[model samples]
Target: MEITIWDEYYELLPRKELEKIQLNRLKRTLIRAYHNLPYYRHKLEAEGIDIHRFKTMQDLKHLPFTCKEDLRRAYPFGAIAEPLRNIVRIHSSSGSTGSATVVGYTAGDIEIWAELMARTLTGSGASEEDIVQVAFGYGLFTGGLGAHYGAERIGATVVPMSTGNTARQVQILQDFNISVLCCTPSYALYLAEVAQEQKVDWSKTRFRIGIFGAEPWSEEMRADLEQKLPIQAFDIYGLSEIIGPGVGFECQARAGLHVSEDHFIPEIINPDTGEVLPPGETGELVITTITKEGTPVIRYRTGDVSSLIPEPCACGRTLTRIKRIKARTDDMLIIRGVNVYPSQIESALLSFKELEPHYQIVITKENFMDRVDIKVEVAPEFFSDEVKTLEKLKQSIEEKLRAELNIHCHLRLMEPKSIERTSGKSNRVVDLRKKEGLT
Candidate 1:
């Protein structure tokens, strides 16, 4: 397949030239944050860090790290570098954990975002001839609008079907002759299930490419999705804190996601000590947005865990690539001294042919000990089998999970479509220990 690069000039720039551009933008962003944002200004001044003296890219480490907590403390407008008058748009987190972290964007920032997202779509094999359907949630969430602007910028026909109403979405998929679908990976699976239930022929639709993000997924899930849906699934990585879903994307090579280094710098650091790790070492991802005019974050610690791939990609883009995110620092679950991620369990479950793609991890405290119970849906044919056979399959799944996770866990086999589905990010883990007032 021929690779499509939206901005060949920057995307294909030599490493030395790209670094020069990154250095300049990095300096400009540091100055903007230091002078305009009070939180950043105070942090810099207290640390005795002089933004003007930022002569080299290495000086970035001397600066303080920006965490989600800092953004929350900044609240509605503290972190915004540009004045409110210049800020033309606002997007925020769900604040389900604490206070919502609000992000602002100037017109220039939006333009940069659109350009990056256009690059994202093009890298994922989208073109102007494709009819794109965006199902990411709109409004406060950035996924929907961010993708919308990018599809339009690339001159692709876009259907802004902002999440929910699965039936309507399936109908549009069948009627609109949509060529590209954009949404969370889990939701894509749900859509495929619904379409199958409705007896819609996947080969009849024009859907060919699926750009999935807003949540971490596994390659196993990708294979499952491809098997069920007639589309090439591509992973797009981004967070609202770092300009939504266009930070990076996978090329046709599918080796790793190419970070748009001209606009944002990517780094992998030890999550515990904050030490920048060497290439190929997995750690938390840190991003610095250089061209952002509004909420410019310096060394922002994105909790997502991934590694930097230093090798050149077959797609010929020189931008740095980060491995697809499979786990997050915040999402790690410690059960009986064993560290487990939902993706690990998902991979293990998907390896079995008799199981469906839907599953949930429920963590609770039993007798002051952490107990993990996984509930997964079985294929209809298997679900209707004799009890003895079902028990044997359940034991086999438990053993598979134990071998994969390195910890024993109880497995509950559920009937087909027993687990509830979501139109947005899937709720795969439910930790009842917190609700039970257990530490």
Candidate 2:
């Protein structure tokens, strides 16, 4: 129950103790799941797996990998291990993919999550002496509650400032003298932009650190966030299935995220073959939470693409660090920052009657920027006019995308059949940013 907060805390422990302790946790989790979770028991039986055989981390490779579909197939409550009475809280996933994924937690599960977050805050120099402000949304969304509990556990003064109303958020920053901020990277940047217009003295504010996550952002974007905001920024990573943001966090040294391996075992593997990859090799991340009580999953394929490093970091933590996500493997274009999937775009575009579902997304390079071309094959009636329908369609798409993604995107229209068809997963974005950068 009293796990140390950082990898460095246990790095010096003899190799035998580390393995012995981890095995004990693993065995207990397996024994508990086999008895309480029918899905897990059935899965183990179907796969003919004996947890006793998986005595070491190396044995993880032999277990069947889990995926999001596994959750969908066991929807609502099948995956939950603990009974309804013990589950104290639940949160909905942002779900860019489809219907939101729901994550549940028992009181003990919440306690452990708070412990990791408290450890993370301490690593970043937050303490009872600091005031923590949370700007993420509350209710079903996980980010707000996650930060609130972490801040509370750390004994910091907590300000639960859920999203929307920029002026109010700014007022809290000035009045409360918030020393730490926990919110999405975009929202932090947005707040800074408002402060600039309002002539807010950002430097005078007490904020010393910002923990941003819940959305993918670029290093360039991260730099922008730090420069504009009043504090140094650290990346926080989590998912609904893994008990939210405390799963891994960045320290001031900023090498990579320190994974909470005591609770969730992190691994990287080839997206296609599920072959376990070595540290520093970029691949999809899969996590199996050993500590969750209400709904526990083993070898859950997170669908997030990242790499891992096992070496002790300069920050003196021996915990594993996961690289920034390259992209989500299952849902969409897993490029750098953009998470847009063509199917979701199609659904949006088709909502307008004038636009045809038959459109092509041509991702290309131009002038050191990503040139994305959305070619919507116009209906025969609209094509009859000599006036270029492309321009109007471009405007419509630009407006819709701006409203949806909060970023400006260029649009293009092609006659039907312009997009090259393929038998497998089709290319949605042809990134020319790489070539542009090279030249």
- Highest TM-score against the true fold, candidate: 1
Model 2, 66-159: lDDT tens digits are 6787676666777778888999987767654665666779999889878878867776778899999898788777788888888899789999
lDDT by residue (144-217, candidate 1, tens digit) is 99999999999999999999999999999989999999999999999999998899988788889999999999
Off by over 4 Å in 1: none
For each candidate in turn, give its C-alpha RMSD to the true structure in angstroms: 1.1, 11.6
- Poorest lDDT segment (10 consecutive residues) of candidate 2: 420-429
lDDT of model 1 at position 257: 96
The estimated TM-scores of all candidates read 0.98, 0.75
Q: Count the backbone clashes (under 3 Å) in each candidate.
A: 0, 5
Assess candidate 1 and give its TM-score to the true structure: 0.98
Candidate 1's C-alpha lDDT? 0.92
